[model samples]
Structures are given as C-alpha cells and as structure tokens.
Target: MERLFGLDMQLIADTLLTAISVFVLFTLASYLFFDTVRDVLKKRQDRIKSDLDTASKEKSDALCYKAEYESKLRDADKEVEEILSAARKKALQNESKIIDEAKEEAARIIARANGEIELEKKRARDEMKKEMIQIATLMAGKVVAASIDEKAQNLLIEETLNEMGDETWLS
Candidate 1:
C-alpha cells in the first residue's frame, strides 16, 4: 500500500467501491419507477384536456341558446307591433263608419223637418182660402138684398168681377 495524503490506501479503495454501488442502485431504482410516474402524469394530462373540451362545448351551447332566445324576442316584438297597427286601422275604420252614420241620421232629420214645414204652409193657405170664400158669399147676399132689378144686379156683378183681378185664375 502507498501512503498518500497520510490516508490508508485500503480505506480509499473501500469508499470508492461503496460510492459505485450506491450509484448503481440509484440508477436501477429510477429505471423501475420512471414508467409508473410517467403513466400517472400522462393520465392527469388527458383528464385535464377532457375537462377543458367539455367546458368549451358547454360554453358554445350556452351561446347558441342565448342567440335563439334573442331571435324569438325580436320576432315577438314585430308581431306585437303588427297586431297594434292592425287594431289602430280597425279603430279608424270604425270611427269613420260612426261619423258617416251620424251624418246620414242628421240629414234624414233635416229633410223630415223641411217636409213638415211645407205641409204646414199648405194647410194655412187652404184655411185662408176657405175664410175668403165665406166672406165673399156674405157680401154677395147683402148686395142681392139691396137690389132686385136686372140692371142693378148686372152692375153689382161687374164690380165684383173687377175687384177679383187675376187672383181667381191663379187659384
């Protein structure tokens, strides 16, 4: 044995041998567990990817539902407007019909009033004519009592004819 750095040569040889054995054991342990550790990590990564894909699909589905609901709301709004417009048009037509009916009724009433007025005027004229005839007959009787001769009767008659004028022919 050679004495180097005042340490025993046999002790150095034993230490080196122990270090080599530990290194070999460590390498064998790593080789045995590496596949198991890698499999666990790979399974965890696959589960995370699946979860992310599911979440993305759910988000897209929610967006599609929101769009569909918005479209229905818009269609409902248009339908409401159309119904209201149609109701307004019907109301206007009803108003016009009522106005026309009122006007027609007023016209009928006015025509009836005019007819009554004309009828009343005719009745008054007829009554006046009857009174005038009675008065003329009384005057003729008085005249006949005062004069009995043919010449006097003829003179009275001629005077009565001249007073009547063209009014007799009009009646």
Candidate 2:
C-alpha cells in the first residue's frame, strides 16, 4: 500500500484506537447494566419482606379479635347461667307459695264445714229434746185427769156394804 493521501499510517493508528475505546465503553455499559439489575432485585426483596411483615401483623390482629370474641362469649354464657339459676329459684319459690296458699284454703274450707256441721247437730238435738218434753208433759196431764178421787170413793164405799151380806152365799 502506497501513501496515496500521505496519511496512511495515521489512519491505521486512529482505527485501532477507536476499536479499543469502543471495547472499553461496551464493557463499562455491561457492568452498569449488571449493577442496576442487582439494585432492582434488592428493592424487590425489601418490598416482599415488608409485605410479609404486614401479613404477620394482620394475622396477629385477627387472632386477638378471635380471642376477644371468645372471651365475650364465655362471659355471656356465664351471665345466661346466672339468669337461669335465678329464674329457677323464682319459679321454685312461686310453686312453694302456691302450694302453701292452697293448703291454707283447704284448711279454712274444712274448718268452716266442721263448724256448720256442729251447728246443725246442736239445732237438731235441741229440737228433739223440746219435742220430747212437750209430749211427756201432755201424757202426764191426761193420765192424772182420768184416774183420780170421785170414782175411787164411790167404788170403795158402796162395794163394801153390798159385799158384807154376801158372805153367807160365799159359804
């Protein structure tokens, strides 16, 4: 090759230097790409960790809410048991009172019946005694009025004189 432009050596040297600079630039660009990719991956990991932390917190909150609900349910159950116990006691008391009242009423009715029966018996006995006395007095008066004095005197005195002569006939 002849020096046609009188710059043949300088052109060849400049072409070599341009080739080296392009190679260095390509290497530096590849390194920058790798570093940026690493940074993006780290950021993704941090984001994922934050998301996991939030999930754990939510789970704990849910557990707390469930525990609170269970506690409230237990309290409500205890209250219900107490209410039932009170209701049962009240019902028993009412039943006892009702039974006592019924017994009292029964006793009163029996006492009243006994008193009425006694009164009836007394009235009947008094009426019977009064009737008996009246009948006895009437019979005694009739008997005495029919059986006394004049008849007795005539029969005794007249019959004795007549019977004195009849002694001969008797022999």
Candidate 3:
C-alpha cells in the first residue's frame, strides 16, 4: 500500500525473502559435497606422487645395471689382451728354439764333411807310397842285370821318371 522512491514496499519484501532462500540452499549443498570433492583431489595427488617415485627408482636401477655391464666389458677386453700377449711370447720362444736347432745341425754336417776329406787325403798318400816302392824294386833289378856307364845310368833314370806321369806327383 506504501511507495518509497517510486518502488512498491511489497516488491522489496518479496526480493529479500528470495535472496535468503538461495543463500540457505547454497550453504546446505557446500556442507554435503565439500568433503567428497576434497577426498577425490587428495587421492589423485597421492597417485601422481607414487608414480613419480616409481619412475625415479627405475631410472636409478637402470644406471646401476649400465655401470655393471661396462665393468664386465672392460674386464673381458683386459683378459683378451693378456692372452694375445702370452701367445706372442710363446711364438717368439718357439722361433728361437727352431733357429738354434738348425744351427746345431749345420755345424754337425760341416764337421762330418771335413773328416771325410781328411780320410780321402790319407788314402791318396798311401797309394802313392806303394807305387813308388814297386818302381824302386824294378830299377834295382835292371841295375843288377846289366853293368852300365854313367851316361847309360842317367838315361835309365830319365826313362823311369817319364813313365811315372805328371798327375801322380801332383796329387
């Protein structure tokens, strides 16, 4: 029934009542749903933290495995080098032994050849002595059978030397 500043008093009272009803509904909704929303957000945050922790642990384990593999590879390389070095040393020793044996065999062969040459020289000298003795006996028989003057004796000696030949004296 009354009007203030050209607005009805009944309309103002109705707007105030509607605003109070909206505020009461909003408060009730917050009281009922706030705990559920907070719990869901907390659970999501905990799951993300757990996933990050697992990833970090796995990365650390992979790094440790890489280091162990590298160490084993280095040890294998060292063992291979040692085996190659030992093989080279053994090959050198075998070469030296073979060379020494060859030298010893060569020395023995040279010594045997020299001994045979000496034996051949001795046999040649003995044969020459026997030929000379037979020639001297023939010369004595000729001298006793005929009496000769100095000129005839010289002729006989010259003929005996010519019959002996040059090769017999040269040897």
How many clashing residue pairs appear in each of the predictions shown?
0, 0, 0
* TM-score between model 1 and native: 0.52
Show model 2 residue runs off by greater than 4 Å: 1-50, 133-171
RMSD of candidate 1 to the truth, in angstroms, is: 6.8
Number of the top TM-score candidate: 2
Clashing pairs in 1: none
The TM-score values for the models, in the order shown, are 0.52, 0.53, 0.49
Q: Arrange candidates by TM-score, highest first: which order?
A: 2, 1, 3
Q: How well is each residue in 56-139 modelled by candidate 1, as lDDT tens digits?
A: 999999999999999999999999999999999999999999999999999999999999988877776676566656655666
How does candidate 2 score on lDDT? 0.78
**Which lDDT values do the candidates have, in the order given?**
0.81, 0.78, 0.81
Clashing pairs in 2: none
Candidate 3 Cα errors over 4 Å, as ranges: 1-55, 133-171
Find the 10 residues in a row with the least total lDDT in model 1: 162-171
Cα deviation at 36, candidate 1, in Å, is 13
